[model samples]
Target: MCKEECPYDFRLAEVVSKLKEIQARKVLVQLPNGLKKYYPILRTTLEDLEIEVFLSLSHSWGVCDLALGEAKKTMCDTILHVGHHGQVALYTLSDIKIVCSPAFYKRNPIPLATRGLKLLMAKGCKRIGLFTTAQHLNYFQELREALSEAGAKVHTTQIFPWMPGQIIGCRFDTIVSNLDRKVDAYLVVGGGIFHGLGLFVTTNKPVIIADPYSNRLIEVAEEASQILKKRLFKLMEALDKKNYAVVISTKIGQFRLALAQKIRDLLRGRGKVAELVVADEISPSLLLNIPWAQAFVIVACPRIAIDHQEEYPYPLLNPGEVKYVLRGSLEEYTPKDSLVPNLSLNNVA
Candidate 1:
């Protein structure tokens, strides 16, 4: 039984059974920040089962940020990754048992969906594109039914490596391109305006965030427009910059050496000083040390440039924004072409 202390279902019983089935004596436990408070529940359960648990204190951004290396170093045969799921690769690749235990929120999303429906209908959004984060996926069916019962045509897609109607921060372009033509507006059933803003910017369509935690309907059209304007200003500043540093992530799943190499070559070809900077985590303070580059182009996750631009003193450009620096024209941006390809276990790092 799930404890009353945590609202999310950690599926402790299922995890214990799996560990027993695999005869896993030593296990590594991983949890995202939001789910860290309930780590004691998981740790206690695992300890009761005589499973040696090693907790990872590293940042758990997504399924991509698995603690496989940590498990290897600690001699743990299995990894219990919590809070997200549906993107697991086979154990053949890692030679270790990787169990993904996704935490599902116990709260119903219908109330927030009903409120968002009214807002979406008021904006004349009859065709709704539905999407949400991994935690809210358990309520996806009921939320879709609520929208359809209200006379809205709902469109959903099972994007590779993502559940039906699921959206990751980095893959907004892939999601928008697949559903933009099919829907009039997007209704994201998640916690914040983060995914909603991504959809609005990518498709240039109206987006409604059905926040279950706050029980509110958030319209992100205006916010996305403001973000676009800021990005345009940054891109304009990038055009006149002489030196460039293209950042490539060293994270297992986010590593994109090929795209970073392409950007470096593109800048050097234009008679600009360019070099590739490798990093495990990209932050403003870390980049501030490199004083030579006037601007930096991120080839890892595109959201870093769009959402966290104010933190950096210099202009931060995504791979799609690099065209403005090269051609000196603000043509239509299609991140599908410039960014790295879709992720798969075989291709990561």
Candidate 2:
């Protein structure tokens, strides 16, 4: 649940009013994975407004494709996309009227447990690293100072090229890789799973995540643990997994495709036989040739790759930072262990 003073309610009301005015018959409402908690509320609200809404099960790319199809079929007059700054990848200005709501939380001026300082004092962790989504960077300077006074060295990286308000998933990896091996442990301040989990997975290190609105450090840690356990089980099933041929594309715009290639190489090095599915453009027909492939990993810009793979059940590896699970054959691949850490919070103020 959001804090009692959460600002998203007012914004949701405004967006809903705009949506109602359009009265689209086959409206597409794309909800981000982070906002899963509010899916029921959003769906109920849209239904109450008498709008025929279809929720895209996939991420940004999938949402765009659904909206595009609706536009092509003349099935819907408008699309309402919601979530973090990264959801911008879902549309072109011509296709749909995009409304972005970047979520923000006010951090208490007081430090919460002085995590950085405690690490420094206890383990001599001089070089502390800080990473978070773009929306939360406004308070970074203060957070940095608090850590510094706690006798720890600090380094900060902003994953989004734009301001905190405009940052999204597109720049996640670029920022995360910049901090590789640079600090002892990472400290993340955000409300969603993408930012923290993305950092945790790629960096392969212990991360301390803190959220001010609710008791998210523990909750998120639990969610991450469950996800990791599922991922691990999936990996184990793949031990005898000869049914799938992973595809890597050279298409320049597909960063996820490039990352898919990297993952393919890693898998092959571990004795898996994966195939590269190169194409001028990603389409269902082009992917159909690999009938033996239980899953295809398309790495490209999220917009193009995800738009193309909307109907597929294969898991997608996003270059932007997070490795997302898509609805399809790979859903059954579950892990045995949790990858996130459950750190206790000291909510000051």
Candidate 3:
């Protein structure tokens, strides 16, 4: 079972066994929207084990609210949070058990035959835009230089504001808004279809996704490609569309808002329309004046608001660059993003 090609094949059994060992009476299960498709199987598996389960779904901020709420209610003896890159906080457990599935896989190197990259190079791809899951953001600099030497320009926006070291799944609007129209195509160097699909949803131009574990570039197949094509056409038709606004807040003594301002300047320079709504703590109603934005971006130091109990209604955008931020100033803390090769399932939990 451990050697199964698809980890899902044996994961439930393993989870059940672990729960039994802990004598877990109740369990909490949290997942992102992307993984909602698999909830039926998960629910059935937990019920078979005779464990009471609570389900919570978050679009971007993984496990933060669910974990906190579970902690307050003392509702479960075990917790399982899935569909994230393994950044879990806001829940403290001295005795209760907690487990998380870090969906990390190694992909084979991308082949050079993909039409998107080929077309991009032909069109003189001097500058490139990059975004990824929060855990992988540390590698962006190396990736940037790699693409630069490959003759592509590179730019990255710390999209999520509140959680710096985690990926903000819901706040992809910032990435889309920051797209360099001057660049030939967008490059997403992360796992799964979500990252690629997010960028694809916002632009008609080419998007080259390099997931080393998946070993394939997401391209438009004749059938599935039509959906991507339609999405791209819609985004292109909506070009120069300014239907959204974002409010950025910063942590005390952290430079998150400064970086966000820089990103704002970059977006404006590219001729995209955007407005800085508010940069301070305020009610959700503060956004009422912005004319109903399509999305919002939050920029703050890692773990700043994790214990603060602040809440917001909009989707968040975290940069996943906490290590870099901390390394530049504080020396006592080890940056979580340090390179550790050949990541396995154990590394994620």
User: Which model scores highest in lDDT?
Assistant: 1
Question: Mind giving the per-residue lDDT tens digits that candidate 1 earns over 255-274?
Answer: 88887888788788888899
Candidate 3 lDDT by residue in tens digits, 52-107: 87776533245333353453385687777664533332223655566655443323
Off by over 4 Å in 2: 1-29, 33-80, 86-97, 106-110, 134-138, 164-173, 192-194, 213-240, 245-349
Clashes of each: 0, 18, 16
RMSD of each: 4.3, 11.6, 14.7
Question: Which candidate tops TM-score?
Answer: 1
lDDT of 2 by residue, 127-153 (tens): 767655534555666777787787777
Give the candidates in order of lDDT, highest first.
1, 2, 3
Report the error of model 2 at residue 269, Å: 15
What lDDT is reached at residue 199 by model 2?
54
TM-score of candidate 3 to 2 decimals: 0.41
How many angstroms is residue 46 displaced in model 1 relative to the true structure, after the best TM-score fit? Answer: 1.6
Model 1 lDDT-worst window of ten: 340-349
In model 1, the runs with Cα more than 4 Å from the true position are: 86-92, 333-349
- Models 1 onward score TM values of 0.90, 0.50, 0.41
The better-scoring model by lDDT among 2 and 3 is 2
